[model samples]
Each structure stands twice: as C-alpha cells, then as structure tokens.
Target: MSTQRKIVFDAIGSVTTEQYDDPHAALEPGQVRVAAKYIGICGSDLHVLAGGHPFAQPPTVPGHEICAEVTEVGPEVEGVEVGDHVVVDPIMACGHCRACLAGRYNLCEPPMVAGFRAPGFGRTSQVVPARNLHIAPRDLPWQVLAFAEPATCARHCVGRLPESARENVLVIGAGTIGLSVIQALRIMGAGQITSVDLDPTKRQLAATLGADRTFAPGELDPAETFTGVIDVVAAQATLTEACTRVVAGGTVVVMGVPSGPREIPLPSMQRFERDLVSSGMYVPSDFADAIAWLADGRFDAARLVTDVFSLEDAPKAYARAQEPDSIKVLISLSD
Candidate 1:
C-alpha cells in the first residue's frame, strides 16, 4: 500500500514531510472519515514545535482545529453521511472513564486528542469517532465552521457566568478565544462589552466581532469597573493585572493558561471580595452550545481569520501566526 504525506516537526523546531502507510481502512463500524476542508493552527501547536509546550511531540501531525466534509460514516452513525460538512469536536476521551460518565470528558483519564496522539488533519484525511463530529449550519462558511471546537471552549466560559451578568462585560485578550468570548457575551444580551489586548489588530477584530469597546491594556482605567471580566490570556502577570483592573464586586474568569509558579498579593485584591472563578476544559453541552451559537447569524466572525495556508506551508503558517498582531491562521487541505 502507498503512503500519505503528513507534516511533522523535529525537536528543534524544524518541519519535515513523512510518508506513513495509507490509512484508507473503512471505519470499524462506528467511526467517521472526514475529508479535510481546513484546520486552524493553535498556539499550542506552535508551542510544541518551539519546545515550549508541556505536551510536546516531535514527528507528530499537529492540527486539532479542524473542519471538514464527512467522506464516510460507520454503520452505527445514523446522522452523518458522505458529503455532509461538519466540524470536529477534537476531544478524544475514553468513554468508560469516570469523568466521561459525568460529562466532563475533557478530563478523561488517559486523555487523548487525535491530532495530538493519533493521526491528525495536517494531511488529506483523518478519522475519528462519529461522536466527535458537530454538524455545521448550512449557512456558515466552511472556513469559520472550522472553529466549532474552539467555539466549544468559548461557550464553556460563557456558560460559567451568571445569566444576569451578561451586560457590561470585560474580555481580556483579542485572540480567537477572546473573540469567542465576545461573541458569546453579545449573544446573551450584553449591552456594552469591552475587550482589551496589546495587539491592535486583535482589538480591532474584537470590535468588529461585536465588542462595544476595544482598549489597549495600558489604556484601561483601573477604577474597579466592569460587572464581569474574562481573562483568556492565562498569563499570571496579565491575569493579575486583569484581576486588579476589574471592579470589586465583579466576577473574574480565568480561562487563559500560564506557565507554572506565579505570585499574587491576596490582600491587595480583597477590597471588594471579587469572585475569582478558574475554568478548565469543556463538556459535550458546551460544544453543543457552540454549534448552536455558530448557527446563529447575529455576528460576522469571518474577520477573525487573517491567513490560510496549505498543509505544505503549515510550518510557515505556524511561524507567521506568532506575529504580535496576528489574529488567526487557517490551514487548508482541499484548496
């Protein structure tokens, strides 16, 4: 059998193409094969290439942000069919695990995401459990449909907030996740939402995506303003700053991940008893919410994309996406 071409990286940040045996075997009665339309390169993929991520894997096909057309469906798959456009949920959890039973599958014991451990979408095709597929709205572009997985993460954050606290929200960072937070807030009836980011491009993108106000972190007033604040950057310093910048009675949501070991003065932030809620990964419900929100035509999210590169150019796309002002990078396979 011939092999397929896949992009893999070395330990020192070098990218190379490798040929593994062709994987055209039919799904084992319950799997789905998706023909790649496009996949988004995540920051973690770049971190893995740069040897900065904890879950680094060299000689691995890296792409979890995937959108595609269903090329084949297993016998048990009742809904998905050939030629049906869909997005991958990308959460490969062991169904028998306790966390999976409780619906907190992201915390599945022996956690595995296909793009990280199994074959990924940085190739012509990939297969996963049909449960991982989320049907995209027929009206949404296939490019944006690729975001359903991350949209799930964003929906998870919004789900954590009180329904009444949707108005006058503050979102920190202008990356894809931040923009997702903005979209969620707007959908829930937030009257005036604000976003803060150092990158002007992302801030502008946030504004275009329904953020009522966009400000550089340096330009925000530290007067304990805003009813709710979401820190998606996950930097200790940035989160600390976000914590301090929010109003006393407000809720501070930390979805951004940061490196190990950081300090924050608890006494300094005790003035108004701010609610510090830390969030982890998503559940199936969050992803369902994300798909439903994507189906909603309230906002124009195509502006979130700034670049689309072919799988052959995955390395360069990963490199350039690290630019200070870059928003999101898409990797196209069918085009």
Candidate 2:
C-alpha cells in the first residue's frame, strides 16, 4: 500500500504532518484519485488553526483550494481522465437537500466543505468525486490553477450584487479574496472600483489588479459612499463600516466568514432599503466561469500567489500566510 503525507491542525496554534495509508487503493466508482499539485492556504484555514472557525475545529486536515493532476479514475467517471490537470471544487452537497435540488448546493444545510467539515486535499493524493473536478487548461501554471476556488467565490459574490449596485463598488480587504473580487468586478463590467486594506502593499496590489483606487483602512473618507460594498474582512468594525458606507439603496455583500457572532446596522438597513446579502461557497457555474476567466487571461492568477512552500514546510507556510505581506500562500505538493 502506498503512503500519503498530510498536514493536520492538531489544536489551536498547533500544526503537524502525518502519514496515512493512501486511499487511492480503494477508490470507489465515480471517484478520481488525484496527485495534488498545489494547495492554497485560505483565511478560513487560518481561522481553523486559531480555533476561531465556527464550523471547523482542530484535529482536522485543512486544505480546500487545490490544483491536482488526475492519476486514476474510477469505474463511472467519464469526463475526467488520467493526465488531466484539474481544480477541485471542494463543496460537497447531499443530492437530496433542497438547496442541491435547486442547483444552489453552496447553500446546502450542514454542507461538508472539504478540509473543513470533511477530509481535504492537503495530502499527497486525494480521492474526490469526478463531478467536483474542473478540468483546467494544461498550459496554465499550477499556481494559477490553484486560484480557481477563490476566484469562483469572488465571481459568486460579485454576481450577487444588484445591477444598480454594480456601478460604484467598494471592496474592503485586499487579501486573496478581496483582490479576486476586484478582478471579478472588472471582468463583470462594474464601474469605479475602490479597495481598502490595512497593508499598503496589499493596497498597491489591489490597484494593480483593476481597483481604480486603494486606501489604507484609516485613509478612506468616512463621508464617501459606494453603490456596492463587499466586506471581505467580516470583522465587526468592517461590517459596520461597510453597512454605513453603502448608499441608501445600495447593497452590502458579506463575503468573509466571521469568527463569531457580529451585529450589523439593521435599523439603518431597514430605514434606507439597503440590502444585505451573504455569499456562501460558490456554485458550479461560478467555478466554471472562474476557470474560463483564468484560462482566457481575464483574471491575473499569478499575481495573487505571493508565496509558495513545499509540503514538508506547510506549517511554516501557514505562519507565512498569516503575515500581512502575504496574499496567497501555496503548498507545492508536486511539480
């Protein structure tokens, strides 16, 4: 039997690498065994490591943003084949759920998100449902393919904005998701995008990636308002600021996963007809669009990847990812 190496969050502030029997030997029908190429360290992964995630706790494997090469396909798998480079759509939904029935699996109740609610692709190899694999262009770098998940999320979040709110957009947070949001807005034809981040480096990167304006958190004018506001840093302060800074009839898209319960300006929202919407994980179409955008050069995938570490150095990668200067940190599992 082959062995696989995986990184696990043992507890708060603890990360460990362990070896396990490869599951590829028992791959079931409709499943594909993939050799992980690159796995991204997401904000949610950090939250889990800090014991702040609402749904995910420690003693779990953590890696959801994945780019892998298919090594083998099970009996019923057809579209995906060996030698294909694919991005894993980590959202696992039960087919019977109402949300899944409506093709809104991202909203499925108690959904099992790979690396959070379920085992993820943090290991050397993973057996995933073939349906979850999005065949990526062979020519795209694995680092670029690794961004499909975040880009899919950004696409979905931007799609949630009302047409009226798309004219003038303000994105809070210039991290991976925030930068992706800016790119998505531009590709979707939004006008006048502005970004806010605490890190000047991130702010500059935001401007480079299609944001018309970038500002440090404190530098933004309090009196200015935007037709749409996307809060990628869902902290209480950021949420309040986002709600207040949106135009009276505008929409605020909450894209960040809050660490804990937080309050919004409900009274103001009611008074002004301001819409508040939450973007959960993305749907299939969003993933497809993200891949298409990345393949067509609409999204600058390489720029988002700020750091890469070998799988053996995943703990260090996590620490580096937490640094303010790091945007997207990836663990390279294979060439």
lDDT of 2 by residue, 1-335 (tens): 78888889988988888888864577788888899999999988998999988788898889999999999889978888799999988988886788899999888879789988878778888888998889989998888889899999999999999888999999999888999999999999999999999887888889999999998877888799999999998999999999999999999999988867999889999999999999988999999999999999999989888899988888899999989788889999873
Poorly placed runs, candidate 1 (over 4 Å): 1-3, 267-273
TM-score versus the correct structure, for each prediction: 0.90, 0.95
How high is the CA lDDT of each candidate model?
A: 0.76, 0.90
Q: Write the per-residue lDDT of candidate 1 for residues 13-59, one digit (tens) a residue.
A: 87765667875886787799877888887777787777776664676
Best by lDDT: 2
Task: Show pairs that collide, candidate 1.
Answer: 224-247, 234-256
CA shift at 114, candidate 1, in angstroms? 2.9
lDDT of 2 at 65: 93
C-alpha lDDT (0 to 100) for residue 64 of candidate 2: 94
